[model samples]
Target: MDVSMARILVLTALAFAISGWAAEEKPMLFSPVSEEPEWRLLDSGQGRFTRQEFENRLGKIFDPTGAMQPYLLFDDGGVTLFRDKARTRPLYRLTFVPEGGAGEVNPPLLGGGDPARPLAGKVICLDPGHIGGDWADIEERTFRIGNDAPVVEGELNLRTSRRLAQTLEASGAKVVWTHDGFEPTTTLRPADLYPEAISYLLQGSLGARLPKYSANRLIRWNAELLFYRSAEIQARARRVNEELRPDLTLCIHYNAAPWPGGRVRLTSANGLVVFAHGSYTAEELAFDDQKFHLLRKLLENSTPVELGVGQAIGEQFQKQWGFRPENYEGSGYSHASGAGPYVWYRNLIANRMFDGPVVFVEGPYMNDRNIYPWIQAGEYEGVRVFAGKSRGNLFREYANQVAAGVIDYFRRQAESSATFTNYSP
Candidate 1:
C-alpha cells in the first residue's frame, strides 16, 4: 500500500475504535481526586461553584422565575436550584434530550473539491475570546500602566482571528466571526443587567475582589461590573449555537496567570494550552441539553480530530515561535486525548455550549518577560524576524500557525476518505 494510504487506514481504524468505545461506555461522573489548583470538579469539594452558587449564576443567564427553583440540584444534601415545574419528563435525571434549537454544521466530506484549496466549501468560525477594545477593562482582559495604552487581549485575539480568516478564505474556506469587534453580541450589557450580574460576582470566587459588605452600594456595584466575564461568554455561546453554525469553532485567547491583587505583572510562565471539550462536571451533566451535548461529542468521534488539529497547531507554534505545550500536575491539565501534550479536556463554556467541536487555544502567557514585549509590539506588515525566525507580524504568525493546522487536518481527512464523495467518517 502507498505510504499515505497506510496512514489513512490506520487513522480510520483508530477512529472506529474510538467511536465504538464511546458507544460502550456508561455516562461517566466527574469526581476530582486531587487538590491540585487545576483539578476542578463542580461542587466536588474543590469546584469553583457550589449548588447554590451555580443555581444563582445559571438563573441570571437562563432562568428567572426561581420557578425552574434550583434549576440545578446537587445530591450532596444541597438545596434545589429552581422551583418545581410541570413537565412531561423529570428535570434532574440522566436522560438524553434530543438536540433542538438551531441547526448545526458538521465536518464537510472531501474529494470533489480542488486539492490545492483543501478547505473549499467548509464553514469555520473564529471566536476571539472576549469583547475587547473599549470594553477590554470591563471584560477584565486588559493589562495596562496607569495612563498609557493597554494590552487588550480581545484586540490581539481579534487581530489574530482576522489574519486566520484571511488565510482560510485564501484557501477557499469561508470563515465566520462570533463578534466583529470590541462591541459584544449580547442583547444587553452588564450595566443593563446589573444587580443579577453583581449578585453572581458577590457569590463566587470573584467575590473577594468586591468591596467589604459595609461598602456603599454604588461602590460595590461598580466593583461587580468589572467581573462581567460569565455573562459576556454566555452571550458568545448563544451566538455560536444560534448564529454562526460552523463545522468547527476556534476560541482564541492569550493566556495569563492569576494576577496577584487582580493586577497584571511580569510572570515567568509561558506556554500554549489548547482545550477540545471533554471534562463534563456533574453540574453540567444534570442539564438535559448538556447531557445530550456530551453524548453527541463522544459519538461524533470529533474529539480525536479536535486533538489532531490542536496538535498540529501546537507543532506550528513550536516551529515558528518558541512556545511549548502547558503541562501541569492536575486533572485541569490531565484527561489527555493522546493526540498532543497541549490538548486538554476542560469543560469551559465555549467547549460545552457550542454546537460543534470547539478548540479553545490559550496562547502564550501575555505577562511573560520575553512574550510581553511581542504583545506590545503591535502589528506590522509583511515579514519580520523574531526569536531568530522570519514571519508575519506577531498576530499574523499566530494566525498562520492556526490556519496551517486546520489545513493539515482537513487534508488528512480528505486523503483518508478518498474513496467516498461525501464521507464524514
Candidate 2:
C-alpha cells in the first residue's frame, strides 16, 4: 500500500482501540450504547428528562456548587443519558432504573378535599425547627427589640407544630413529634460532644484550637453546637431515620434576614420557601455510604416526588398567607427537580441524613415590619383586625398553612395512585 494509506489505516485502528479501552474501563451508567454519551437512567421512563423540563420546571438543571458530571442530555433517537461533559472524553452510563415502566410520571400534588377532616390514614412527622420556650436564648433563636417579648423562632415554630399536629390528628392522621417541647432529643449532651464540637469550631486548625477557658467565637460556637446545632441535628436526624419512620417529615422553621452592621431591625421582606433534597455536595460525596445514599436517592427517582410535594405545600402557603415562592440566585438554591417553582435544592443535614422524604419549610421573616406585631401578639383563636381568621390565633396560622399543605399533598397522592414505595430510596 502507499505510505499515506498505511498511516491513515494505522490512525483509524488507534482510534478504535482508544474507544474500546474507554468503554471497558468506564462502563456506562444506564445506556446500552458502547462509549456513546447517553442518558443516565435516574428512573425508568419512556424518555429522558429534557433540558426544557429542567429549565421550565426546575429553573436550572446543573449544580453550581460542584462539577456537572451528571448532565441529563437527550437526543432525537429516544436515548437519554447523564454524561460528564467536563472530561476530554465523557463517560455516559446507566446505573439505575425502576422495575416498572411508568417511571417518568411526576408524583401528584395535593388537591382539594374535606375541610373538617382531610388527612386520613396518613402518618406524618412534625419536626419543630429548634428547642423553643426557655431554651430559645440557648438556641440563639431569640431576637429582642427593646425586650418586647423577644421574637423567638423556636417558640413560633413549636407553636405552629403543636397546632398542626392537633389539626392533623383532628383530621385522623397519625402524627409524630420530633420534639415535644423545649427539651432536646439528642443522645449525647453538649458537654459529652465537646471534643468533636471544638474540632468543628476550630475549623480543622490544630494550632488554632482554643483553650477551654478562652471566650472566643470557637468557644461560643462549641457551646452553640452542643446545645442546638451539630449535635442537635444528629438527634433530630436519628428521630426521623430510626425512631419516627413516618411516611414524610415536615421540618418547620421561621426565617430571618441578616441585618448588616450587626444591627437587628425589622424589614418588610415577607415571603415563604420550602425545600426537599437533590443537590448532592462534594463533602457529602466524600463519604462512601452517603455517596451511595445520594446516588440511590437520585436513581430511585425521588427528586420529582419531593419537588411535587414541596410545590403542593408552597401553593397552600400562597393561598392561606399570600406568601410568594422563593427564587434564589446561587447554585444549589436555584436548581430544582422540575416539579415546582418553590422547591429549591439544598444539602441540609436533615435533607441529607433523613431516609424518608423531608420538606424543609421556611416561612415568612419573623422580623418583618408587618409580621413583628403579629409575632408579639401571642396565640389566640379567631379572627382579628390585622391577622384575620384565627384557628388558634395568628401563630397557629403557620400550623394551619402546614397542615393544609400536608393534607393537600396526601390528597393528591391518593388521587394519582402514587405510592410511597415508588419513590423510596
Best candidate according to TM-score: 2
Ten-residue region with minimum lDDT total, candidate 1 = 31-40
lDDT of each: 0.61, 0.61
Q: For candidate 2, give the lDDT.
A: 0.61
Against the true structure, what is every candidate's RMSD? Answer: 17.5, 13.8
Q: Give residue 380's lDDT in candidate 1 (0 to 100).
A: 71
Per-residue lDDT tens digits for candidate 2, residues 258-295, read 67556988876787778877665544433333333444
Minimal lDDT window, size 10, model 2: 29-38
Off by over 4 Å in 1: 1-114, 146-148, 198-228, 260-263, 282-296, 299-301, 331-334, 382-391, 419-425
Error of 1 at 128 (Å): 0.9
Candidate 1 lDDT over residue span 25-65, tens digit each:
32222211101111112222222233443343333322222
Model 2 misplaced regions, further than 4 Å: 1-118, 201-217, 282-293, 331-334, 387-392, 418-425
